[model samples]
Target: TFLDAVSRARPEIGDYPFTTIHPNVGVVQTKDGRSFILADLPGLIEGASTGKGLGHQFLKHIERCRVILHVIDMGSSEGRDPLEDYEIINNELKDYQMRLLERPQIVVANKMDLDNAKENLERFKKKYPDVEVFETTTIIHEGLDPVLRKAADLLATTPTFPIMDDEGTESSVLYTFEEKRPEIEVTQVEDHVWQVTGTKIERVFNINKLNTEEDFYLFADRMRYMGIDAALREAGCMDGDTVQLCGFEFEFIEN
Candidate 1:
């Protein structure tokens, strides 16, 4: 509901609670031509700093976010105090390895339509006088414009936090590739049965898999150019021998 209020990109909406397996993104462009991306990252429980309840799965995405819009249920619809929830989330951000609390954060008091929401909001304000919070009832699209504009303004000034410490910050590959395998391998698996195995052989077979004579000639010509015929003869493949390649059987012939 809040995501829809932010960008109006209406995705699936349900009342039941579910795990956010991955994040969803939406863009917001203010009237003054300033724009920023907002990601709906959920699943931050009490122990998110130590990787609990989809903690690491979601927190890793926070490293790149320059601003965090922490939405609190002021309505207490879930029977939890708003003040406690605020502290818990900020604590988790503080405990995270990336020092996430250092980023600019905008507090949101959501679900203002529910009962006791105003009372809880008063109590929350009394507890944290310095913190500025925007109130909203996302279900009905109430009190959303100020929040959107404020987020865009903050993004205009807030620089992105460095996710890595080393100089290899320019998209470096992580994995070391294995040594190259031969393109073609001609093996004598039996007395007269020769099995030709290789990635190129399989690719050729898969492409020219038709049973027509013209297709077979094109396939044989590709194999010849790749030196499979000479490799087979060197492996002691004789004329009239049964050659198997990618499960297709054909009799060998010496030209």
Candidate 2:
């Protein structure tokens, strides 16, 4: 009752091209016949916690991964600072989900062929003496077997889910999608001019870049066409009313 999925592809699917990177999520059955889910999350950078650079997206993918494999670019010729990069990514992961801090971690020092990599590995070992590490160079297929073997061994030992207390029950949270219509308040600002504000209108304004007359007209048209005009009209907005966004105020002339 044991199985394994092997991929000989240069880079596994759904991964960004080049720089020896791959993102994968799959179930692995151990030699002992136990199965568990695993995820290969993308390396993160500083400001990832704030969703600065696909950090939030990447973090969300690993939310279900009980274990983490942090692969570092050991060679780092293109100015990829490993230590700081490691710290920044870890911080982002911790920030996104606190539970990730408790997950078991392993570090993979990749690209050991470069001269700087040996020096960096020495520094990394000295700094993080306790971290389990595996060095590999994908170009020549060197040191990969040991790394894969260790990963498989670690996975075999790691549990699928966090151990729960005897008395602790799961969360009583239930989610449902109920399409509720937007509640707009009809406020008479001065005269026939009414302020039309809601999540629907605000979201439309956010994505619309009014760089040209055509774009501006398109924005207005979208707002009006999305029944926003009808709602405003029903809310007592006259044809000659003044419409004000967060900063820019426009004359609400229905053409």
What local lDDT does model 2 show for residue 238? 62
lDDT of 1 by residue, 1-255 (tens): 577677855454222111111256788766677777888765365676775423564577889898999999999775667889799888888887586888889999999999899999999989899999999998887888889899988887898788854543476677878676566888787677677767777666556534344545666677778888888889998876766665334567776
- For model 2, residues 195-235, the per-residue Cα lDDT tens digits are 55555665666676553445555765676577766776777
Runs of candidate 2 with Cα error greater than 4 angstroms are 1-6, 9-22, 25-38, 162-255
Separate clash counts for every candidate: 0, 0
Could you tell me every candidate's TM-score relative to the true structure? 0.60, 0.52
Q: Which pairs of residues have clashing backbones in candidate 1?
A: none
| Quality of model 1 by C-alpha lDDT | 0.73
What lDDT does the true structure give each of the candidates? Answer: 0.73, 0.59
Best by lDDT: 1
Candidate 2 global CA lDDT score: 0.59
Worst 10 residues of 1 by lDDT: 13-22
